[model samples]
Target: YKASIPKNGGPQIPDELEDPKAFKLKMETAIQATLKSEKAKGETYSQDEKELMIWYNYHFLGRGKPTTHIQVLSSVNNEQIKKNLPPVFKEIFARISSKLKHQS
Candidate 1:
């Protein structure tokens, strides 16, 4: 959900979000043209889709354990997103650090 600024100093929107329609078009074109042309050996389309979903779940949802989440949130340097998230995610995110803060 966060985007690092590009080296060109342009507005930092992730490629996936920058122009979803364009991304979809590119994906469809690649699948229908390039791969078909190459006759690349790979899993079937349905199998590939399933594998992508599994990978997404593992990499995105699986890593959201509270401890890892805290570590990641604490490292954010984006003041705007950090500020915006605080009101919404504060209690959930603060459980660990707030405990430490109280103890200290």
Candidate 2:
């Protein structure tokens, strides 16, 4: 995903979010929140969730396709939440990217 983002000229993380664990935790929390909110509003899972579920089923479940709506709507609120991160959080992301490039 990071690789693809650069190809499109998207904003890069600075130096703060470089740790894989921190990145994963942040992403997970955001996705879970998105899923919960969508479920509450009865909007069904979003496009990103569909893509992720498809990948999970193919790789983890060894299936040709997703078999259940539950799996499709599992959890993507984390990503949605990320879309609305506060300014401080954005700075952290920028810092993470800068650190990756050794741009002290």
Per-model TM-score, in order, reads: 0.24, 0.24
* Regions of candidate 2 where Cα sits further than 4 Å from its true position: 1-76
lDDT tens readout by residue for model 1, 1-104: 22332355322222557887765544444444434544543346664553343333333444554654565566676786567675547777788788899999
Which residue pairs in candidate 1 collide?
none
TM-score of 1: 0.24
- Per-candidate local distance difference test: 0.49, 0.47
lDDT of 2 by residue, 1-104 (tens): 22222254432223334676754443344444434443332236574664354334333344223443344335436786578678899999999999989965
RMSD of 2: 19.0
